[model samples]
Target: MTDVLVLTERELRAAVSLDLDAVDVVERAFAGLGAGGVVMPPILSMAIEERHAEVDVKTAYVPGLDGFAIKVSPGFFDNPKRGLPSLNGMMIVLSAETGIVQAALLDNGYLTDVRTAAAGAVAARHLAPATVRRAGVLGAGLQAELQIRALALVRTVPEVLVWARDPAKARAYTERMAASLSIPVRVADSPEAVVRGCDVVVTTTPSRTPLIEAGWLHPGLHVTAMGSDAPDKNELAPAVLARADRFVCDRRSQSAVLGELRSAIATGAVPEDWPVDELGEIVAGTKPGRRSADEITVCDLTGTGVQDTAIATHALRVARASGAGHVVEN
Candidate 1:
């Protein structure tokens, strides 16, 4: 018989919040990835164009981990019109040796939010300038708020700029984050303003067209573009890659197909044989990051399955230690 820990969203939240610990867990996973021998497959994505929704399946196996995880994440862009949230999903963990179910983390995308935001923090930690007084975000949704919070853990942020197509959402996000993060969060007049006004910028929107242009990139700027996890979505113009002094991808292979890199490659901005550095390689120190303070660095993160497995494993361990979930025997 095997015992499976079943955790609800609240229980998992009690176990794993979006903190520096979460950032370290994802960072370690990246280190393992950079060291090699980690088996992370391509993302399985299904887009229902009719409803403006997508379902993504991602999974991975790290060499030293006791269990691997498979995560199913769905985003229904129109859900907000229905007065519901857009993102919701869960993860399942299986033992590395026996292939038995270890836990059912019914987090409803909470873990994904944390891990994704943590990846942003990791990007800022290694790539952003030494001092970041102002941070800028392109979206006013969950990820925008979390990314700022995560960046604060790595850098001191006294001010933040946010821009969304919907002015109401941007204003609401500004007010809420200002009160919560104890920092000034203001609504930017435009995407250009957000990019130009801050040293570090994160784009979290679902825009099909480019929200950021190449001309806005400045010296000592760090941009983390995480919104384009699909073939049809893009946030940064292809030339943005050309303008960047240093470009980093979460996974070169995956980014070449599904992330912003693909768009850049298609438009002839970045060569097919450009030879870029993966975030893992930089994290592992096998590759360099931001050689000089004047370099404009960009990180393309499509999100990886190793991160899912890593965070799921970490959350499960914490849940057990804190007695947060119910165990089911099968």
Candidate 2:
């Protein structure tokens, strides 16, 4: 018989969150990526154009970890109209030594949400200016608020600016975030406003076209574009990469085909062979990040399989210690 721990979203939430610890855990995973020898593959993705949905499967095997995770995440943009969440999925963790199932994290995308937000904090920690008075976010989805919260973990965000296609959602975001972050939150009239007035900006929308122009990039501005996991999604103009002093990616090869780098390359703003550094290299201290506060920095985070493996491992450990999940023997 094999025992597999099964954790629901509520149990997983009780075990982990968008905190500094979560950020640190993800940071270490990036470092492992930098150190190399981790077996991570390109994401396997499928599109359901009829339903306006995309499902992604990601996994990575780290050298030191005892287990790895295979996560299945789906995003249905039109679900909210039917009173359902746009995002939902789960992670399956297996033993690295024997390839046996260890845990089934039925998080319904909650773990993805936490780890992605933690990655934003990781990017800001390594790349953003030391002092961030204001942080601007381009989406009013749950991630918009979490990104601001994650940014606050690495840098102080006394003011927050948000812009969303739906004015009602933006208003709701501003109100709710102000109370949650205990900082002043305001709705921006345009994406330009969010980028121009803040030292740090994070684009969390799955925008098809460029929402942020290169002209809006100012000195000391750090932009982390986290929404472009697919070839079709782009948040910043391709030229924005050329305008930045330093361009970083979670993974360069993946970014080249799947993230903002793809858009930049497609438009010829950045060369096909542009020299780049991964966030992992920076975290591992093998490469430099944010050489000067006045330098403009852009990080393209399409998300990574390593992040899923790390977070899933952490959640399972916490659940085991806290006795949070049930186990089924088969």
Candidate 3:
């Protein structure tokens, strides 16, 4: 009989928080990827255009880890109108030694959320300015709040500026975030306001068109574009990438197909062979990051399979140690 542990979202949440430790695990995974110690497959994505939904499957095997994770994520943009969350999914952990099923994490996409946010923190830690006074967020959704929380771990951000398509949503986000972060949060009238007012800007919207223009980029501004994980989505103009002093992405190949890098390359703003650095290379110390205080930096994060494996491994470890999940025999 084989025993498999089943962890629910609540139990997983109790075991893991989006803190520095979580960020470290994700950072290590990226470093492993850069060092060629991880085996990650191309993401398998399918679109359900009729429902405005897309599902992605991601997996990676780290050489030294005992287990790997296969994550299935579904995003239905129209779910909110039906009183359902726009995102939901689960992760399956498999033993590296025998490829046996080790655990099933029914996290309801919580682990994905935390790991993606942690990646943002890792990016800011390596690419953002040493001291950040204010940060801006482009979307007033779950990621908008999580990205700021993650950024606080790397830099001292005392204030926030948020902009959303709906002014009411932006105001609500401001009030809620102000209470949560213990910092003043203000609503911005436009995307340009958010970009011009803050030192670090995070774009978290699933915007099809460019929300940030090239002209808005200035010296010392760090932008983390985390929203464009699909081919049909983009948040920054191609010219914005051309203006960056340092352009980095979580992975070059994935970014070319699904991230903002695709749009830049498509528009001829950046060459297909441009020496764009990966966040992993920077984290592994093989490449330089933020060489000057006045340099404009941008990191395009499309999320990765290695991040899923890392977070799932950590969550399972923590859950087992804390006795938070149920075990079943089959």
Question: Largest lDDT belongs to which candidate?
Answer: 3
What is candidate 2's lDDT per residue for 1-330, written digit by digit as tens?
999999999999999989998999999999999999889988888999999998999999988988999999998999999999988999999999999999999999999999999999999999999998889999998889899999999888789999999999999998999889888999999999989999999999989999999998899999999988888889989999998999999999999888999989999998999998999999999999899979999999989999999999999999999988899997
lDDT of each prediction vs. the true structure? 0.92, 0.93, 0.94
For model 3, give the 10-residue run with minimal summed lDDT.
32-41
Assess candidate 2 and give its TM-score to the true structure. 0.97
- Best model number under TM-score: 3
- In angstroms, the error of model 3 at 206 is 0.5
| lDDT of predicted model 2 | 0.93
lDDT of 2 at 229: 83
Give the per-residue Cα lDDT of candidate 1 at 59. Answer: 98
Candidate 3 residue runs with Cα over 4 Å from true position: none
**TM-score, per-candidate, Cα-based:** 0.97, 0.97, 0.98
Q: Per-residue alpha-carbon lDDT of model 1 for 1-330, expressed as tens digits?
A: 889999999999999988889999999999899989999988888989999998999999998999999999999999999999988999999999988999999999999999999999998899999888789999998899999999999999989999999999999998889889987888999999999999999999988999999999999999999988878889999999989998898999888887889989999998988888899998899998778889999999999998999899999989999888889998
